[model samples]
Target: MSKGQPNEVTGRIFDGATLRKILAQVQPYRGRFVATGVLVVLLSGLVWVRPALIRIAVDDAMPTGDADLLLNVFLAVCGMLLFEALLQYRVTYLANWVAQSVSLDLRSKLFQHVAQFQLRYFDKTPVGTLVTRHVSDIDGIANVFSNGILNAIGDLLALLVVIGTMFWVDWKLTLLVLTPIPVLLLATRIFQRVIKKAFVDVRNQVSRMNEFVQEHVTGMHIVQAFGREKQEAKAFAAINASHRDANIRSVWAFSVFFPLVEMLSATSVGVLLWWGMQDVLVERMTLGILLQFILYVFMLYRPIRQLADRFNVLQMGIVNSDRVFKLLAREERIEDTEMARAPEQPIQLRGTIEFENVWFAYTDEEWVLEDVSFRVEPGESVAFVGPTGAGKSTIINLLNRFYVHQKGRILIDGKP
Candidate 1:
């Protein structure tokens, strides 16, 4: 098919859906990820084991005056702690390795794809936006690989272990403590919307600010010569103000979001406390179970809090990734046609070219050049002299093939 045929190119402004593909980009390193996740889960599971050992030491060993039980529980707790540390180290090593590797590969692909874009694409797109995507966006994606993706795995592991242990000890109390999660989830979704809007404004404002500063700096001579520093300063101040407002709104969203989530988390703890007291006093549940329950509750809270924080960032990352994916997905307006032939040997020019019966237009309704004809031969001294609308530059542009003519034959050194 020819370059200008139907579906020649497509474009989109956002590409969030492509994050699944991006995440799958790490499939080559799945073994590393699986090892890391398994290690993290084992490490998190060991944390729950400590409380179990503590409950045993207190309720069984100490009460029964069993010296052997006391020694065994103490040793078991130490062993679990050590194993947790070892697993943590191993997981960190694997995660860092995979994250770094995946980020490197992503960066390489972004650079390569950008290099493949048409020169006109870069000409029309802002250098600041391009540089920002090339550097800042890619770096942000790397941060996601390390901080968001890896931490989510760890957080999930910790949550499962804590919740599983809680259910094992007492299912009804676990249910009580978990009652606030739905509320928290709803709040988090609201927070996600706010954060997305705020961050979009923040990023746009920052980009504008960068563009404003770049323009001012690049044109400082013109501004100074025209005595327009005050005007330029006013423009810069406007851009800065918008940037500041967006940033403040982002901070406000996060500030409100995180604390509300914290309060919700605390509410769960409170419910657990109330249920535990009732179980202890009225239901005759033992003190050790309560203590172990409290410990597990705290452990569970850490993971939940972490999970909440990571989810917020992950949401933002996905949004940004979508933007990047959409950009990456765009096809250039013009490309080599299928079955287009490459020149096998360089053509030697005799400084002779011919343009015959040319008709061209920027659009169909307006012809910029009509029936234009020109010839230049070796040692020819013909100079184009005409008024402003005489198609002088258009002649050069058509001769150089910057734009193809609707009806014309341009012969260069012999080949058309």
Candidate 2:
């Protein structure tokens, strides 16, 4: 969890504590959150209605020569479709609104937290790495609220409703049509496992690339002065290649999994046609019911296929959240106790400065200043002359309270 270290991928896709932290972000927008949930459930529950209406029009209205009933059913289907569209719009808008609001809040909090951190923290952490956290990682967390977890829940519910309705319509047909589902499920499980790792690698590579570019760009003068432009470009190319490879792995998983889903969907249709024709020939099932099963098969597989994708989105969000939270958890900020605060009113001073038995280190046991002592009387102009890396700047930093000396009594105006 150290700064600049790659995040470790957990065996589980979602962490409970992480999930709770994410949901906690929704507290301020609870009304929108609740409304989104309700709409998703409502939309899922109504998934079977249109198919049922289509069956009724085909079998009952048309066969009975009831033109009035046919017209009414058509109009009803149109109305239902429109209603679902409106509900979808509200859900999309509400989810994104909550997500964007939460994103803004988190970004602002992170910025303030990072700004207060000690210079030692920044010395060890790369600017590009922090940039990745502020930009790409936060975007991933936003996606969790907008399109990841919530949409995945809706897809799962719609899937169950579609399957349940299929069973109700004709249990035998449903069973036969679902024969290919086990294979599809197995494929999806593999895809999820593979893609999660790929995504984690992608994020890691992105951070590395960001860090490399940031450092090189900021030090372009050094690189040019040392005639190391080609060397730096080669290093950047290697990092960029790693990022590309990681993305290709994720793309490869999608390429394989989606085609497999389509093939399974087609197989289910074939199964339906093969078994349905037998029943139709024997007058045990009507054409209208067979057609309904076809539609139902599509509904069943569509959500199942989407479920895999949505799960990936959720997984990526969790990965990014883990990184962001780790950064937030760092205790690198200087704590200003009550005694450290400046007085409300300014007071004149004689300007005497003293550093008594000061010991300091930017890192563990690597002392930049070892038991150093100094004094500057009023009106005395003292210059700290030293070679590079000889604690000259460290002295100024300690005097300014930019860092706390490990063991020291730094007194200004005879005050300690």
Candidate 3:
């Protein structure tokens, strides 16, 4: 398998709203997602309680050397930590199972559709294109449903927790931390177009590379015979260079977007630190609340970065889904009209054929046969001798139903 291309499917894919609609396939997981969410909620509560625990440790428990209070905090913290760890494990396990299931379903559907597609559809389409859909697109979609959706869930819940902890601990610090979201959103929206295009370019180049390798390997003999190996080498180098450039562009865009997001997150932490210190010295906030706020801030960022990263993968998947869906959506042609089957008691008949008023045309502008006819009865040795481009081979073609007659009926064993 090719090392699937970088994401070339970004800007042109379905919008975020549309992507969510497609993600509705995971609707069956509503119960699981909700359960996980509740776990996360409980987990957040544990996180929120830590500040108070610290306050007790620093301000209350240690103040008068209260050994009993310290022991209680230690036991409570250990219990909450264990539960949180279990929740994390459950969510991760469930998400992975869901990811594998969805990817398998998508690939199976796509394969069924492609299997039924008419010959004409595949005439101009490269096998590489289809392979990309099966391999890359399916994997890309798996990436979306797996890491993308899971991270999104975590991000959303974490955001709620962070906000809640903010208000509960220090709304002033929360306000400072979140003030950059709108600005970041605006910035993301602005660069989104470029980032999407860069990703698409990378995927396209990778696909072309796959196609190139396939063609070259298949035609190795031709290259050797024609003594064009050196020239082909240069051609391949150009393709490799194109692939490299596309990856560079994608990486460049990613570098810009991710760091900017990180910076926005960093700035929020810096602002929170400055604002919280003021409240701290003035006795408006306690040491424990500030510690919880910092942890919440750390928790807040992971999802932000995850969402951004997953968006790119989701975009790539959506792009591939279009092609896969096209394959799945195609209508079959050239099906047998009769429920034909091999007879239980088959009779072997000698080869013979007959055409009655047979007419044929490979295209509209010319008729290889026009209202013409022929008969080849059994035990009669007959030969068709005509100049090239005549309907000689066409009669044979019609007899086999390789090219069905447009007018008049064909009689094979006295059957049309």
Candidate 4:
């Protein structure tokens, strides 16, 4: 495989360089990101308020036996819910809008850049590989903005508020509820390492499968002509099987991760209840305060468990960004300098062509055409008679500047 080919898989995970490059692309939308962050913070605050409102309604209003206070608290909770819903909606909408805008900018730039690459690039690099980058890779980056970054931040903030409130209500119970955290964190770290590799494997396998299918379909005539259908089918089956295995590994990682998270969450709940009831019995904690703690624990674990999945999204996005940025970083090998501008009026061509001591080769120093000389005057029809690889197409290509000759003086109407 050539350097331009996409068969090589990059093994870098969580690279600072890749992260910075992706951030530079999203710099244009910093204002929207900041606004979304503010909304997330406000939403987190609102989420914290709901549990407190529940506690107040149960402990204060119910003891007073006052229907009016109960009604007011109920209305307050309803208003908060409505406000939170609006903020959530706005945050999601803005995040997705920014995501798609960034994807548009990225895809436009990628397509334009790929279009300018020399023919040799396409000769070595598969069309399906480039298509994957343009579509699949760009979509991955979009999900980073849409479902990864802002949402992860919101979850983290919500988790923090839950923890803070838990400690405020009762630090002892909070500590008890968090005893399973170390084990959960360890499990999450292992899952991250495994899934990161799995995601990279899946991406590489998908690219290979795409390249294989594309090349085979394009060369279907050759396969049929050579009577190699059965052989090709066997080859395709091997590639397809590898792709399936890669996907299965990724699914297996998810299966293990989610169940572990659920178990940890359940353990936290069990610990909170078992220890919390003792405090309630000793008059150290009220029923309402204990109920509030239980609510906070549930809120905390939900986000904590979701954090692992969000991290997977972030990791996958980073990997895709690396590939996309690598493609964009390629420099155009062919320069368009001093191109001839159109004259104010059209000038008729003399239809004369000349080639003097032309030397050319597709690769270095292995000449296909050496010291070739030819001339044809205006209105004269001429043809070069030769075997199959005798520089016939090469002459046309050089005259058209599809491939520039290494050493040549090719002139059309006396202009080189």
All-Cα superposition RMSD per candidate: 5.5, 2.1, 4.9, 2.7
lDDT of 4 by residue, 1-416 (tens): 22235455556557788777776777899999789889988887766787888888888889889898899989999999899889989999998988899999999999999887776577668777988899888999998888887788889989888888888877878888888889988988899899998888898888888777878888889999999999989998998999999999999998998888888888887887787788779978777887888788778878877787788888889988888888898975565422234668776788789999999987678899999999999989888889999999888887776677777688778877
For candidate 2, the C-alpha RMSD (Å) to the true structure equals 2.1
Of candidate 1, the 10-residue stretch with the lowest lDDT total is 1-10
Give the Cα-based TM-score of candidate 1 against the true structure: 0.80
Residue 83 miss distance in model 4 (angstroms) = 2.0
Q: Which stretches of candidate 2 lie over 4 Å from their true place?
A: 1-3, 7-11, 342-350
Which lDDT values do the candidates have, in the order given? 0.72, 0.88, 0.70, 0.83
Scored by lDDT, model 3 comes in at: 0.70
Q: Write the per-residue lDDT of candidate 1 for residues 110-204, one digit (tens) a residue.
A: 77888767544654556556565666566656556666767787788888888988998889888888887788778767776777677667766
Best by TM-score: 2
Task: Show how many residue pairs clash in every candidate, following the order shown.
Answer: 2, 0, 3, 0
**Between the candidate structures 2 and 4, which one is better when assessed by TM-score?**
2
After the best TM-score superposition of candidate 1, give how far the Cα of residue 48 lies from its true spot, in angstroms: 2.4
Q: Write the per-residue lDDT of candidate 2 for residues 1-416, one digit (tens) a residue.
A: 12465545565777889888888888999998989999989988899999889989998999899999999999999999999999999999999998999999899989998999988888877789899999998999999899988899999999999899988888878888989888988998899889999999988888898888888888789999999989888988998998999999999999999999999999899988998989989999988898888998899989998888789888888888888888899888777744467878876788899999999998898999999999999999999999999999999998888888899788887676
Clashing residue pairs, backbone N/CA/C < 3 A, model 4: none
lDDT of 3 at 339: 20
Residue-by-residue lDDT tens digits, candidate 3, 277-327: 788899987766676677777777776666667667666767666556655
TM-scores for all candidates: the values are 0.80, 0.95, 0.79, 0.90
**lDDT ranking of the models:** 2, 4, 1, 3
Which residue pairs show collisions in model 3?
7-199, 8-199, 8-200
